[model samples]
Target chain A: MAKTKARVKVPKSIKKGEVFQVKTLISHKMETGQRKNKKTGKKISRMIINKLVCQYNGKEVFASDWHPAISANPYMAFYVKADASGSLDFTWTDDEGKSVKKSAKITVAG
Target chain B: MIHKTLETRQVGRRELMAMFGAGVVAAMGVGMTPRDAMADAKSVTDAMMKVVGDNKPATGKIKLDLPQIAENGNTVPIAVEVDSPMSDADHVKALHLWADKNPRPEVASFRFSPASGKAKVSTRVRLSKTQNIVAVAEMSDGKFYMAKSEIKVTIGGCGG
Candidate 1:
């Protein structure tokens, strides 16, 4: 069985309405099913990170769909505006029905 | 006398035909080499094109920043930035990345909302070889833009 893991990094504190960077990386094999198994000599079935969703304070902020061509250990960094202090949850699902979730707290001061 | 006996026991026409047919089958199986892998790749591309319709026009506003030469095709740094203010009125809807020569052309698509505050993203992607990387940007007003760049890979990556 394949598994998915996510690592999220963001600033602990940010200013309201100010843009801050959020970086995320997911570990996946992302098999395209086009290759062959060296030992079995059979086609390896496709496995990929199918869906990713990000929520800030229970509201969806960003989402993406990944394909097999997405490199292994996919890393994504983007900007997010800090509107209020809350928890940002990130979830990703793979082709094998495996899902990984991680959350980070955002605190806005001044 | 031994030679005459062997001649008498020689294979019949039916056995000869069966042997020839078996040999032909074996040869045909071996002849179907993997050299024509490119044909399979073409069909994959055609499917991708159908998914990514021609509704977008190539625009210079989108910039795909990648190294001119990548030492490793397995993990190449890629950045996509669009010249747009991420506002509710005119924010970037989505940005799609594609590798022309990759086994799968649709590499990644990032969906954004105004709350994202920026139409920029950075990530790492796998490239099979030296090929063109294309980025398409969709705006909130149903308009599309794109940009592309060619990257040369010194070593073949993506494990074939």
Candidate 2:
């Protein structure tokens, strides 16, 4: 309902060929659309963030498909290998095809 | 002869109890249905078939991390890891999660690539009640690994 926001955390420093961790969380209600309006007695249509894609240095690295079972304000963590000095982009899309994108920088030391 | 008769009667009674238990669960499922999302519910068998098809997942190489009992079912933490080298030729393709007793068996799916570098993921999920959380990992080599852990939900999350 409000403006959605996302946060990404990457290691401050990285070494070449080293595996690093990436953690992300987004603020969302994740309405399942299964609940009813107590006063109106009508069903609330499902609206949830359905997909997430993580790209490292412009290439797809990790992704996930979320169902209604995912908790509101989802948080996820995964690992990535440092290839070069670049940015990691994360795109979260909802059931309506509307999406939000966030990015973080990664510097791999030679 | 008297002891033998008692043993036979006990076995029959156990069978009857099992039949009644199954019937009760089926009735509960229907009673909770709201015509749409609830009715799309699935049993464990159908859920697995839809994902892995006819190939049964082998029970190893996968680890499921979850609390034995969740104080709050609204947000249950879950982590899954697979033991693999994570190479281009043999890495985990996707990891699937589902709960056995929820109104709907579908949970979430995680897709990975070689760049992922590790066969692990962590997230939070909502559990409708006490149930087994099943995780299945699909490898690039067409092999499937499976693991399951049960979580007792003290406060049932009925949003499902």
Candidate 3:
């Protein structure tokens, strides 16, 4: 069975209107088409996680378009302002029409 | 085998068909060669032009952070941060990263909205050789910002 895990890191709680860092990592094998199969002398088709979008409180915050050059087990870090206590949802889509979703909740204290 | 003299030549339909087949095959061979040659023959500027068009970004308010020297090129840390208020009227729309010496110049692109709070992102990329990594940021106001840094790689990232 293939293991798919989405790791998200954020502060347990933050003051309202404070800026915070968000880190995410997903387990994936970003395959570039440059490699040739050893057993069969044919080029491997490129397949990678092409897009990742982050939404905070049901509003889009950050997104990315990735290429095959990104390292395997893709990792991305960005900053987001903590306004009110809400949830951050992430969706990662690959070239093969597969997508994985993950979300985290944060508490804002003023 | 058909032998003929110019003065008294004999024409055969089968011979004309054979000649036409060879011409078609030769043309196809020429067409197939360029595809393989083009795979690794694109320049950095050409790739960048496809994204930014004729607008060359100015240098400021954008920071591209990467190592000056990387022992292994397989994985090099890179971070791009832009100074923006992240307000409704002003924000970063997209960020494009590229390696000047890689087989393909464009590495990745990141998009941000005002809700992001800050225009900052970090990731890892592969380097083919010692070259400059360029970052171009497109803002909401239709202005562009640019930043670049060079890295020396001991071991190339792209496998030979």
Winner on DockQ between 1 and 2 is 1
The candidate 3 chain B region of ten consecutive residues with least summed lDDT is: B32-41
DockQ of each: 0.40, 0.35, 0.40
lDDT, candidate 2, A7-106, per-residue tens: 9999988998888889999999888766778887666888999888999988999988888888899999989988999999999999889999999999
Q: Which candidate model has the greater DockQ, 2 or 3?
A: 3
Candidate 2: global Cα-lDDT? 0.80
**Candidate 2 ranges with C-alpha deviation above 4 Å:** B1-41
* Cα lDDT tens digits for candidate 2, B96-137: 888987755778888888888897889988888999998888
Candidate rank order under TM-score? 2, 3, 1
Residue runs of model 1 more than 4 Å from their true location after superposition: A1-4, B1-56
- For model 3, give the RMSD to the true fold: 12.1
| Candidate with the larger lDDT of 2 and 3 | 2
TM-score pick, better of 1 and 3:
3
Task: Summarize candidate 3's per-residue lDDT along B44-158 as a digit string, tens digits.
Answer: 5644554454567889999888889988887888888999999989998878887888866768888888878899999988888899998878888878888888999999886
Docking class of 3: acceptable
Rank ordering of all candidates by DockQ, starting from the highest = 3, 1, 2
Task: State the lDDT of candidate 3 residue by residue for A1-110, as single tens digits.
Answer: 04668899999999987889999999887777767788875668787887888999998888887877787788999999998898999999988778899999989998
Task: Give me the runs in candidate 3 sitting further than 4 Å from their true place.
Answer: B1-41
lDDT against the true structure, each candidate: 0.74, 0.80, 0.78
Cα lDDT for residue B147, candidate 3: 85
- Report the TM-score measured on chain A for model 2: 0.95
